[model samples]
Target: MSATTAGGEVVVRNAQGLHLRPATEFAKLAMATGCRVQVRTDAGDANGASVLELAMLGITQGVTLRITAEGPSAGDAVRRLIQLVESGFVV
Candidate 1:
């Protein structure tokens, strides 16, 4: 895939933050994006396709996360992921 990339930042709004369930949801969406996704926080960064890594971030409410994606559909991936985060991981 080409180096197409997109990035954005979003704050955790869910009272529980990015827990296992949310991470699972996130990872699934990320994998469906057809792009490689990376999520960065003050704690660390994690592969967006990995639920364990994302949950391990221990992100709590109010934490701001930087999300970046590379490969085809990066822009759409970033936008949709940001929207998901903004929705507090609601389906």
Candidate 2:
């Protein structure tokens, strides 16, 4: 398991932050990468790659989340995920 440090901060723009649907989608994307990802927020920390943990964060619209990805594809994963979040997780 190769590891690297990747980080970014994104604001929740989707009127609902990462709720069930967005979180699920985000999780699915993370899973596709087969890398370990984690997210941190003022509310708490979550397994960035897990839909369940991400949903549990209860992130609300306008909230800012600090995301980090570390694993074989850490750089790519972090970049894409940040883009996802910035794009309102549309992808």
Candidate 3:
């Protein structure tokens, strides 16, 4: 397993947060960051860039997700991802 790294967090504000479409889009955007990204919720944790794993987080509209990325571009990755999630996963 990779070492646990600290990044940032974003609270979900969308009325229909983290559903299929938004999760899918978030995963795609995260993958494009070229870093290992993961998301953590009260229930569990999962790969941030994987649609299946993200969906498994079971996040509701008002839930907060802790986002972490590790590797060379981890900072940039987290920033972009935080923005995406904060924007209701519109990206």
Against the hidden reference, what TM-scores do the models get?
Answer: 0.95, 0.88, 0.88
The collision pairs in model 2 are: none
Off by over 4 Å in 1: 1-3
Q: Which residue ranges in model 2 land beyond 4 Å of their true spot? A: none
Clashing pairs in 1: none
What is the C-alpha lDDT profile of model 1 across 1-91, one tens digit per residue?
6669999999989999988998899999999998999999999999999999998889999999899999897988999999998998988
Candidate 3 stretches with Cα past 4 Å from truth are 1-6
Q: Residue-wise lDDT of candidate 3 within 1-91, one digit each (tens)?
A: 3433459988998888888899998889788877788899998998988889888877888788888888666777888888887887664
Q: Model 1: how far is 23 from its true place, Å?
A: 0.7
lDDT of 2 by residue, 1-91 (tens): 6677777788889898888999988888778777777889988999876888988889999998887876776788878887888888786
1 or 3: which has the higher TM-score?
1
Error of 2 at 7 (Å): 1.2
In order, the Cα lDDT scores of the candidates are 0.93, 0.82, 0.83
lDDT of 2 at 81: 82
